[model samples]
Target: MRVQLILSEALSGLRRNASMVVSVVLVTFVSLTFVGAAMLMQMQIGKMRDYWVDRAQVAVFMCREGAATTTCTGGVANQEQLDAVREKLESPALAGIVRDIRFEDREQAYQNLLELEPDYADLVTADQLNETYWVNLVDPSQTDVIAEAFGGMDGVEEVRDQMQYLEPLFSALTVATYIAVGIAVLMLVAAVLLIATTIRLSAFARRRELGIMRLVGASNRFIQTPFILEGVFAALLGSLLAGGAVVAGMYFGVDRYLRERVPFVTTWVGMQDAWIVIPLLVVIGALLAALSAGFAIRRWLRA
Candidate 1:
């Protein structure tokens, strides 16, 4: 009976402040949606980084004919130079760091270039290509070690870490995530303020009932329960809406569109990720609303 009465009073308060309830709902919905999006973006960034880090290699390009580098003045890497490089790689100094190394001769390099850019078939020849050593490190971050070892070596033109090209992309994504988080925080503040205002107004409208209940010796918890419930109910509705939006976006935007359009990104935040965000959104919304409403009503009662 007590639970039913509290629920009835909460519903009545919501009806009295219909416009404020709607505002609270909309604000919570937008804030939680941004929160979910920021989380998924971070997750996508992690997936991409993990996928690329495992596969990214340090390319050691051997000197080709007519190369300009001082180390390539010998014109091209001779068999003796290649053997020396192989020996040094297998040497005790680098054995622990180098996980695997694959040597690609000019012909293999040319074939790969042709496969990637067919138009170059007629313009480029096999001899023009550099014989390369693709080195996979046990830890991708140890690229500088390989660079230091081979950068000034005879018959080596250049040593390039593939991750250097990818850092800018990751940095850009991180900035975007920060922007989303900033927007979500601002919206959440708005939602909390709206919830507080709504609860205070409801309490003011029922001041007479509250006074009578106080005279009848009703506890503060019982009196505050209905107003807190009103805020929680509105927040819950908004959270549900946000959850639905996140699910739809993952399905249509990520799964159907991005996965197909962006072939390079093999991994994406999927339905499973959305499921995780949905529950989090609900908890965040409810907790924030409860605290805001509870605080607002407590202050109003004291006043």
Candidate 2:
């Protein structure tokens, strides 16, 4: 009976302040949507990092004819210099660090270039390309070891860790995630304040009824329950809308469009990630509403 009465009162208050309720819903929806987007962005970043890190290799580019580096001043890397580089890679000092080594000779490098940029075939030749040792490390993070070992060697032009190029992309994504978080936080504060305002107005509109209940010996908890429920109901509706937005974005934006257009990003945040985000949005929305409404009503009662 008490639960039914509380529900009835809560519904009545919502209907009385219909426009304010809509405002709360809209604010909550926008805030939670930003929250969900931030989460999915971080997840996408993690997937990219994991995928690239596992396959990252160190390219030890041997000096080609006319190489400008001081170490390659002898025109091209001779057979003895090439052999010395290979011996050092296979030496006992680097046995545990070097997982696998594949040598790409000048012709193979030229062919790969042609495959990537077919226009280059007419202008470039095999001898113009550098022979490279593609070294897969046992631990990708230990790239510095390989770089230090071969960086200034007679036959080597440069030691390039593939991850060096990828770091900038990852850093850019991280900055975007932080910006989303900042926007979400600001919107959430607006939602909380709006919820508090709505509850105080509802209490003020029904002040006479509250006084009657107080005179009838009703407890403060009983007086506060209906107002708290009103806030929670509005916030819940907003959270549901936000969840739908996240699901649709993952499906249409990521799965259908991005997956086809952005071939380089093999992995993406999918419906599974959306499912994880939905529950979190609900919990956050409902908890914030309940607290804000409860605090607002309690202050009104004291006044």
TM-score, every prediction: 0.97, 0.97
Worst 10 residues of 2 by lDDT: 264-273
In angstroms, the error of model 2 at 255 is 0.9
lDDT of 2 by residue, 104-182 (tens): 9988998899889999988999998899999999988999999999999998999999999999999999999999999
Candidate 1 deviant stretches above 4 angstroms: none
Instruction: State the lDDT of candidate 1 residue by residue for 169-244, as single tens digits.
Output: 9999999999999999999999999999999999999999999999999999999999999999999999999999
On the 0 to 100 scale, the lDDT of residue 178 in model 1 is 99
lDDT against the true structure, each candidate: 0.96, 0.95
What shift in Å separates residue 140 of candidate 1 from its native position after superposition? 1.2
